[model samples]
Target: MPRDRRPVWAELLGTLDEKFVANAVVFEHATPCAGLLLRGEPLRTETGALDRELVLRALAHGLARAPELRRRLRPAPFGLTTPAWVPDDDIDLEAHVRFHVGVVATDGPELPVLLAGRLNPPLDPRRPLWNTVVAELDDGRVAIAWRIQHAVGDGLYGMRLLDALTEADDAGAAGDAGVAGGAGAAGDAAADGPGSRAAAPSTSGASTSGASTSGASTTGTSATGTSATGTSRSTPTVPPLEPGPHRPPRSGAELLRVAWLAWWRRQEGPRGAWHEYWRKPFLRRLRRWGGRLVRPVRNHVLVVRGLTESLVPQRRYAFATHDLPPVARRARELGGSVHDLTVALALVALDQVLPDPAGPRLGVPISRRAARGDRRNHVRMTVVGIPPGTTLAEAVPLVHAAVATAVEAIEPSPSRVAEPGEPSRPAATILTTAGLAHASPAPTIPALGPTKSATNSPTLSPGHSAPGSPAPGQPGSASPTRDAPPHPAAPHPAAPHPAPDAPTRRRGYASFVPWRPRARSLGPALVGSAVLWPVLDPRDDLAVFGSSYADTFSLAVVGSRHVDVDAVQRAFAELVLGTADDVVAAVALPAPPGAGPGVRHDPGDQPGRRPDRQPHHQGGGTP
Candidate 1:
């Protein structure tokens, strides 16, 4: 099969990346990226310290089998086509890993600063777009950092790649050292096909074969003379390779096809009963959609009074774990799911921070992984009004209802559409549950050292600074003055007056008209990183990412200097605590017998779902 054809979805994502790049350059920030920080026990061996060369060799061997790691981007010439992925024949493994001495925690106080420094530089698209940094900490542990471009893979894929390099048992550890070189022989270079356990589009632009085992080596090595197999190798510097030739881009016709396919995919959906109302002519459909749109949340103003932007960017991370069983129980009692509760918690938290009671429309992502033949960037968001000034108990059901309505209207792909009367899965399920289809567990590499979860600080004090106060040129805490100009890109009111009430729903997404003033897409974007990739954009006023592991919940909040971190932290703490209080109140009443507190339930489980599960699709504007 020809490997030059690019998948429509991949090309669409690459085109979006180009837009994000342009936006970041104009806004003085880097394009959004995803990262992982791993820390583990010390790497030690019976003989002596394992050298960096062995570690490099093992990683190089593993990455060679993972085609995504060896695939550099080939841009389309003259903006005529979308970017394509091609094999990188000349890879320099040594350039990707940075060696550091001392104890570095993955979830440590110093992590944000360190991560920012690494992220400051834009990725060189000419080469494979990723890097792994290794650090040996004073605590006799090792820290590994993985950074990958969003276009290459999502969070689930990143976890799988990490798993391939790890070993869970001593026997597995013994096979790790030599595993790197021999791993490539296990490569399955064919495309990932529909229903394959491992999914990645082949260079031929088809989703066919499963992932190659070349990237899944058992042995890992570190500088402490320890390998995953307990062997040690002499230290030697790995030489860099000469750069490969640049490949020619696709034709303009292909670029046009890519854009057209993306648009068509955005409108795919089932022809179901709920959509019957949308089949009317243009005017009739418009009138019916207009009425339903008002039922959703209202869009609020972006600029708040008494707030200013800071020239520097800042981040504050906070971690806490709530009892999942109790929270899950409360959601069920309210006729909602755990996912609904998470969104409510976010909205309530925003209300506490924003000057206005009602918050801005949120960009809520809905994963489209069920789509056949689509192995890349299959996510669409539904914009909805935030329910501020409402209690968790009152808001839970409302947000749940609103989300269900929005998903039904916005999802165009048939794979994601629910059967008639079948309830849509809560977007929150991505964060609240474990055992998602994408995650795989593997053993630790001995050379890299045994891995462990980093200790999380119980609570982040308001206004408290990270261990390294200000990294190099970063600014210390300070309030911005009114004179500080607002972000040039974000929507600003002509004056600082109250924003008008939510406008009537327009027919053709009129608000996005290039001629009219538009709302800034640089405001806060919430991400639940428990399962999906966490998108961190430097230009946003605030980016909040949350993850729940074992019995702990962690939050990493990144903001520009213009925002108030102390105030936001206080509000966030209150919101989380408030939810816990609600859970405690509900613990007194046991759930109806036979209903497990955490059993997975969906619309199909409801008493009166239409017996025929399939729903019909309709043609109309989405809310």
Candidate 2:
């Protein structure tokens, strides 16, 4: 076989990182044939500042690097030096260019992180990176969705791509981390790729008309610790905090306390299991419960191969993007952009549920895509705290500053990622490395879409036997609609507001095993975590990025019937709506969120996500 002589970009795409755990699952169940091929979606912005033409040019550049793209698409693995997947570049274009872009319903259950835990997606080892659907909602919002092989990028990489293309002026380090930090001269030796904040051609240059560019938004730069994993939480109906303009700069000690407090609050309760530093026995119980109840929920047939029918089940998901322009505007009265103020509102929402303020730690991804080859799939997952002591008067900045610290801590390339670990088997891994993929069809708005059953016939099945007719994507199974492309242009709006200009929220949801097994039905937390990943190939880490006031905002999710969905949708929306002002302030003035050098300082630990099942790419957790 003649070795691929293509440029790094060209050869890169030739061999998808089959070693990733997520890749194996996708390969095993891919429609028996390859589906679509697209990179991630374009960054969403209310300002419509993205340089579409430049984006096209970037795509063209990617096409020119066909060999690399082909290499990226292959269902095989490399000898694991980061799987030999990343390509060198000067801009954060690789992540965007590697796959195609598409959208899903704005109103649906939040997407989960497939192959995140400790297993990898299964792959057929015969195709290319499957697909990425950039979903556009009628409510003026957008979602970048995909299912590339797990071997490609880690959670950090996924987060990096999402963070890079986001509107830096506002999304600054994806909420807290989105603060504009420093600048770097493009193509300069000291700032070439990975670690530098090199300048990209703006969406306004002569050759540019629509595509937008970015400057690193991490304000609170630090050699801080990176943590994107956290406990699952529900939407709380908190009353808005009294508006105010207050606070003086905190001493270093005070700053750390506030940041940790915020982080601890989210991680303290039952929802805080996600933050458990060491896997506890309770974690085992949760998995056992999931396996007993959720995994074998529906059995198709052994005709599918390796697993049984119940593993991957067909399901529906719904979420809401409640509109809050009124509340958002009102929030500005306190501080920050609509984004920052939104976080203040979310703090109110979450507070409504539990009063005790043992704030929890949460993970936020930092995009290293801006650094050339780093973009191939270089996601830098970072964690930040909501500060247990965060108060309304101090929240906007409190969270802003804390997240800022997290964003700055994520370097383009981990300082010393141990020689990439040996690839693991698929299936058995946990959620750590897994990414959740979803499909939001026709209705487009947060209303009812088509309800067709997914199928995985014996011919398509590798060997496992499923019960009834094999449906597309059963739990522990896979269902891919590669042939169907999301509406090329946002679909006809289901609501009177037909235009995709308004950030619409998707409202579809599906249920998974419950966090609390005793409940008759599962809630959004588990459903959002489990259901969303099976539909699309396991490569994408599509989370919910929505507004709080959108019509469907986590409202109606109370009764048993709606529990599985309504809640998760709202939580995803809250995540989107939450924002911080001090985060921006910190970035503008160079205040890293917390303490430390930001690198994976746990010298004895491995910083990458571990997926279960499959190879190099995988998800984690006992299940």
The CA lDDT of each predicted structure is 0.33, 0.24
Model 1 alpha-carbon drift over 4 Å, by segment? 1-14, 21-39, 45-58, 105-108, 115-122, 137-140, 153-338, 369-372, 412-500, 503-533, 536-539, 548-553, 562-623
Best by lDDT: 1
After TM-score superposition, the amount by which residue 10's alpha carbon in candidate 2 deviates from its true location, in angstroms, is 6.4
The candidate 1 region of ten consecutive residues with least summed lDDT is 508-517
Candidate 1 local lDDT, 535-598, one digit each (tens): 4333344434333322122333344343433343344344434432221121111223375754
Q: How displaced is residue 111 in candidate 1, in Å?
A: 2.0
TM-score of each: 0.50, 0.31
Candidate 2 per-residue C-alpha lDDT over 102-168 given as tens digits, one digit per residue, 9 for 90 to 100? 2221221222121111111222233334332222322222222334444434322322222222211
lDDT of 1: 0.33
Q: In lDDT terms, how accurate is model 2?
A: 0.24
Candidate 2: misplaced stretches above 4 Å?
1-19, 22-69, 73-125, 132-147, 150-331, 338-357, 368-373, 387-394, 407-565, 568-623
TM for candidate 1 is 0.50
Residue 65: error of model 2 in Å? 8.9
